[model samples]
Target: MNLSGVFYLGWRYLVRNRIKTLLLVAAFSLVWLLPSGLALVVSKIESQLRVRAAGTPLLLGQAGSPLELVFNGLYFTKPGIATFSFGETEAIDESGLATVIPLYARFSVGGGGGGKYRIIGTTLDYFDFRGLELREGRGLIDLGECVVGSKFADANGIGPGDAIISSPETLFDLAGVYPLKMHVVGVLSPSGSPDDQAIFVDLKTTWIIEGLGHGHEDAEKLGNDARLPVSAEDRAAAGETGGEIRLNASVVQFNEVTDENADDFHFHGELSDYPVMAAIVVPTDAKGQAILKGRYGRPGGLQLVAPSEEMDELFATVFSVQDLVLGLLGATGVGTLAIGALVFLLSNRLRRAEFRHLLHLGAAPGAVRALILFEACFVVLSSLVLSVVGLLAIDRFAPVLVRSFFG
Candidate 1:
């Protein structure tokens, strides 16, 4: 019996029933691919999350879910997490045990395609802590000036000197949170982190966007048309000994902060009372970290957590679910392989008459057996190749998918 001839005969048979062959290959490929692909994606997400979490020593925020605080501080996610007064950051800073970098990431800027990127209000210390470098221009300096991340700048075609407007909290926002146009002063180098997908601005600029600060024409300069009627009782309540002028809705409030009106922008209340979503706490040493943690150990309105520990707890639960899913997939894969084997057995039975015809033509029984074995090998090898290819594709694209999903 010619081995080459047997392989040729098997190949021709598979080609003649190409639909069945393709279906079997596809089913087998999926059986091998699903579990492996899932594990690859989960591992990628875990590494990414753990690396970022490990870099930050401690995260301080209002008492809430530790996972939510970690996500907000590290990834600029969970924007709706409870916020604490900026004075909390001040207290942490005054402790001298650690350096506190405040973060206010509640607002977002919308892209033309309807996607939104976080607006991270932070200080120059944040750049140093993250080791971020500017790819183009400079860092945040003045009011309404911003520095965009490389990914954001590339996706939106933004660069130094370009401007972006904050998206209003809602279409019908009655809270007076108007969109503020901000000038892009620089673009950050690609860091392959969440920072690469954010827009960084001065903390005060975000407050302006929040309606806590504003700039407008001087009330004293406004004409009678822009002045609200003030009754004698109102004037007495204001402690006005003489004529007093009050500006009304007709007075124009500056939406964009320019050098001309920058000085006019002011907050209505104390800066210490301003809201901060979270703070990244960096200790001088291990001892300092322990001391700081111990100080916040007691129950209070604020909580300090070690991000790495929080991540460990999160992945503990995640791994349990992952194991359960893998078990189900393993069972499914076994069932699929059994069905594939059954198909081959029934196909061989269906080709019994053809095998007999081959024997009459002087082909040995061993040659017929070899032909059947060759076909089975081809299907299994083809499916294995497809599964390997699918895993590689998952490895390549899983990070992107995970980042987008988490963000």
Candidate 2:
């Protein structure tokens, strides 16, 4: 018989038992989706992580845990860790082995429409180093002005000229730490990294939040002006004003920094000793990285670590878990295939009378066998197509699905 004739007969048999064909296809498709879908998700996470790690040549921090520091630096997940100082970055920069960028990520805020996002404090080099481009408006140039990530901006309906308020780290603090309002200056283009979920600001901006820096109208200038009420704590923060203390309480401490008052923002003591959670080090060469690593690889808390190596270590554990799951899945797949085979065999046995009648009616035995083979091939091929299509769909949609559910 011609190929088309054989296909027609096989298709007729499948359609005659359409319910059985549908069940078998559904079963096998699910079997294929589980393992393949999980693998695709893991691979997507690993690829994104490696890309972030590869961009930073090395990290220097007062690292009690290397993994914690690396993840906090790259993924912006862990923030309540020991902090070094800007002095470290200055030291590395002076060493001439690499260019160091300080990162201070200790707080988060509620953006427009109540979407939560992290507030990252770093220099303009952070944008250039990360290769982030502005999708709208301009980059952060002044303290208290922030450039939001595309994901955050889109999710919260934030655009240039909108504002976000920092969420207080604690509800109760005797210190005069108040929630500051930050003006959104720009929206960053999506980069498919953790940065896409963060708000970038000048390093001084976070210091202002931390009370280490402040900019306000001179309390001294507000002499004898019966203005807004000023508390004692606000008065103390206002500094020495040699006159009748009738300063505007709002001007006593800067809750917001603007271009007009940017110069007024000053840090007490040496900036070199200012707290920085970590420093991203980009060395000129492999030798420079090795040398810096050797210099800071001390027995004390301070240490230098390679982010890519730390990421590898992290995924080693992930791969172990993946392997165990895949092993169990493989066993389950085998059991399922064996059951499917048994069902096929029993089904064939039940059709023996039909085959015998075909043989009796001048149909050759070989022709009956060929028909059986064709039916079996048709079932297997249909199942295979269903499995492949399901896998492709899962692979394509897995990242977006995961982001929607988890992120």
Candidate 3:
């Protein structure tokens, strides 16, 4: 068989029936990329979620939807679990199972794309716990200061000293309480995790936004311009009765405080009046987590769920459908391959006269056979490459589709 003869014959065999060749390639490409693309997307999302959830030992939250609670506390996506008491938060921290970083993620910031980069009111330890770093600006240093993740900063075109305003937590209904406006003093570097898509503020800042804490009291009404820290002692010294607004906005318009005048400037609220969505807990590992789960998973008590386990279950449920679809696609791809094979086989048989003429002129049977194989392979491979390119384009836009359909 002459190599040159094989090349000549292969080109003729494939290009001769242009329409059939093109259709076969198209079918092959779709068959090749559909399942692979779906698998790639699912795997990517799962891996990202799992990586973020790794250090998390447990999620402690209000007795509500376990999925929502986990999403809020762990991913900072859901509206969030209720705030655990200082006592409850402390016990979990002292649980000796896993070092706990109390997370209170309920407040929203306006101007940040997707609402304040998912504001998380947590302690300084939370940053270290998450392995996040400072890229351009420092971490949260003061109560009013905030550390925005790189993506948050990039999206908002904001940097240090660029303030972020707090919006009411719930946009769905007015039933949710209003969180006060907060500031963004710092921004963080990208951690390549969900943290990269978040904004961080101090626990006190969250308390302030939740109306659990406030800034200053109206001085003229109190008959003193002296700075007053609203500690237990200060409250006692002032002989203040009824209630005091924990936050005193430097930006509050009115200054006077009195029965007649006090209602104008200072905003007042009780600590317990504020609602916190959830807290994150840490147990040692899977076994310790199981033990902890047994304690909280009782019939009518607070629910404790492992996010990874729940996420896995969720992924499994969704993928079961995907698996079925992929199986059908694979079968169809195989069928397409069979049909294409038949087409080429018939084409080869039809070419016998041409082959015989060539053979008479010195073309070998081996060359003819090789020509047939080359044409088939070229069709399959071309299809596969085109399919892959199409799949990548689909992936680029898949998130929007996923949100549109599933969200």
Worst 10 residues of 2 by lDDT: 240-249
Give the Cα error of residue 213 in candidate 1, in Å. 0.8
Model 1 deviation from native, Cα RMSD in Å: 1.9
TM-score, every prediction: 0.96, 0.81, 0.71
Highest lDDT among the candidates is held by which one?
A: 1
Ranking by TM-score: 1, 2, 3
* Candidate numbers, best lDDT first, in rank order: 1, 2, 3
lDDT tens string, model 3, 311-344? 8887888799889989998898889778878887
Q: lDDT of all predictions, in order shown?
A: 0.90, 0.80, 0.67
Model 2, span 51-104: residue lDDT tens: 778888888889599999997788777778899888879988998899888998
Candidate 1 or 3, higher TM-score? 1
Best by TM-score: 1
In angstroms, how far off is 288's CA in candidate 1?
A: 2.4
Give candidate 2's root-mean-square deviation (CA, Å): 4.8
Comparing 1 and 3 by lDDT, which wins? 1
